[model samples]
Target: MVAGTSTALGWLLVLLFSAVAWYLSGQRRAGNKRGKLPPGPTPLPLVGNLFHLDPREMHRSLEKLSKTYGPVYTIHLGSLPCVVLCGYQAVKEALVDQGDDFSDRGAFPVFYRFTQGNGIAFSNGEKWKVLRRFALHTLKNFGMGRSSLEPRIQEEAQCLAQEFQGKKGVPFNPIDLVCRAVSNVICVLVFGKRYDYEDADFLLLLDHFNENFRIMSSRWGELYNIFPRLMDFVPGPHHRIFHNFEKLRQFITEHVRRHQKHLDRNNPQDYIDHFLLRMEQEKQDPQSYFHMDTLVMSTHNLFFGGTETTSTTLRYGFLILMKYPEVAARVQQEIDRVVGPGRPPCLADRKAMPYTDAVVYEIQRFISILPMGLPRAVIRDTPFRGFLLPKGTNVIPLLSSVLSDPTRFKDPASFNPANFLDKEDAFQGNDAFVPFAPGKRICLGASLARMEIFLFLTTILQQFTLQPLVPPAEIDLTPLCTGLGNVPRPYEFRVLPR
Candidate 1:
């Protein structure tokens, strides 16, 4: 009874504290409203638009708000007023046409707490630019987005297929297998080596990443991002996010230390070696972003970016293929016709296999991973669509809306490869297809992801036939969760050798 009373008192104190903080934040917000903001629904005191948003389907909820309040409008997410851009036209105008104006990384509390405004993903201003440029330059030198990396991906794809072959067409979850395979591709580039599939430590780290992604996509994570201050006092799975981040950080730090011991200033092997060299060169400059913390955060950003979305897309794509067997049959036919069974699928053959190419594009479009495309902040107070967006205003370019715009797609609800195919059955592209987003802040690993997805999916299909446990018509394509990324529903499937 005494413990219960203490807990009640604690809760009361927290509520009172939160109310005061909200009031102060609102007062600061009023002073910061530099110009006439876009029109939207009025928010209530303290809660803001929490009641209006369904945390589970945040992107969809925001998209629905567009119907009532035009394409571009403002919505309050717990004291923070965020400008949401819905559909292709609005998103394109802001992210593409007015790219510089909306180029800054927005405030994302879930990531901000861990990153602390350090990494390539969360950092803003000069730090973001320098780190991004250096990472891109180093990646290019190491063959990112180039044909030179194809062999590495192909080798990993074969290992993945061999692992599936060991399954003997039996029911087994391919989550770890696919994740290991995908992560290893980036692993080779970032760490300069890949761990054995049976390595317990590696598997545990992968599990942490998987679990973190799942939790961050859950409603708990959404709540954390919205009311970070209040949620810090609460307890839930969301706490695991920081725990996993620490584990990931420890792993990266160990790798960085190991690389430091074997430092090669002239003969750089991978990303870490290159970064270490840069750190040495810039050690004299006090303001250099090339430091230990940034290195770890940047590595984490690249490693996570390279691993999660591509693997999830492949997993979801496999489910879609099983759900629609005819699509699988047609892809395999194209594979056999173009590449033959002599070798694995390469980037070159993508042009010849238009159907397969279209399928890959359609899969990315259908899944719409990273639906909200990591929020953006306006760099300065700027005129936008007759409204003035103040400096540091948060904006959400709803990539989900762009991918599913009715004007851009014939039937946005259904998954169809024809969305990327022309009347002549040739591979085509759409302006609305901003899966990696548009403009300067696009995902750094976009090209690597494209190559990985194409190679991994085609290689798997060439080697085995995907068999679902349930009827094709009954296979569900809905995501298990919708935050962070569109997490595919987990299932076990059999893979038969072709």
Candidate 2:
């Protein structure tokens, strides 16, 4: 009896010790996790603030969170430590002062799968460097700022004018028309020509592109990026997005192949021709990143970036004009004074139309297409505001804060062009108007985007005055979606002939 009791006691002690050890180990792990991270909202185990987040209005949610946690706050989305930077001062410090250390774009699995780490938008390191340099050089050569591209833009603008004329003062959805005009600009640059609006292939491509953009900003996109391994098993929008990406890839590849077949060494026409000729020149150099995959992805990036941003801005511009008719009238008046009906408005006319210029600036500031300004990663250990940000830390600069900061713009929430103009009614540029972003990773298409916005706005305003189709009480300019970009709710408007 004594021996049996002793043995039982020994076994109980061993089990007790094992339990204690396991408990201590878990405590140590929790402590380590806390130490590694900056102070943030307490999260549940495993999920880590996933349920607390609303992926659609993430910017608004983060803004509220910033108010509680101060300008710089950290949050965990699953295992990812997302550091949100609010206000202009914090954003400028990280993005501009420490550009090199913060230049790396955080690679999400879904984006990686889509882009395959090939394009300038998503790719990092030496590959991005080479492609970006080449893109800027090539774009400049193809008349990005020069007058050579003006005729092409004017051609597209004329088509737009014709479409508006066909509407004949009736209500119409300008989304498709605007998209076609913007897409043609990219098409001319990439494929060297424009497509007819009724062309079957062109329509299909546009639909596919639009669908892809929508899906990318949906809830499924957030889930797929957060838990890619698990989401891969599900059948839904994620699956469709993947299929669309593949289709786009194939389409771009075929175009690249055709360009290769018709390559001219001396006389290159369009982006593909230029790329193909360059590829041959760099064939002997093993370090050359110029190849079929990169070329296709770059072309795809240009198409996606060029079309979506410009079109969305124009869409918002019309919506804003409808919301504020007096503002629209002023813009039309400016257009009439600066650009007569017989002559098309040139870029030089922007200087003369101060109110028109201020309105465009206000639209960019108010809409803020890319609110988050793309996700950037710290390439090296850096100090931001006396805090140590380790290498690979995800830094998201909230550009909306800068544009909408009351300190910077009086009555930031309202759409007032006076925010950009002086008492003399002259155009006054502000350093805080950073819609296209700034520094090393600033938008490659800044000049092109500016030109497009100015030209498109002046052209449309010169021809028609946009007004709401519904009652003033029914019109809502509140954003309906936030993903790859912030898009306004769908609304109809009549374009009355000026």
Q: Could you report the Cα RMSD, in angstroms, for every candidate shown?
A: 3.6, 9.3
Lowest lDDT 10-residue stretch of candidate 2: 26-35
Q: Output the lDDT of residue 325, model 2.
A: 81
lDDT digits (tens) for residues 99-212 of candidate 1: 999999987889999899997988999999999999999998889999999999999999999999999878999999999999998898899999889999899889988998
lDDT of 2 by residue, 226-284 (tens): 55655676567878877878888888888887877877778888888888888888999
**Per-prediction count of colliding residue pairs?**
0, 0
Whole-model lDDT, model 2: 0.79
User: Alpha-carbon error at 452 in model 2, in Å?
Assistant: 0.8
TM-score of predicted structure 1:
0.95
What global local distance difference test value does model 1 have? 0.90
**TM-scores for all predictions:** 0.95, 0.90
Best by lDDT: 1
Worst 10 residues of 1 by lDDT: 24-33
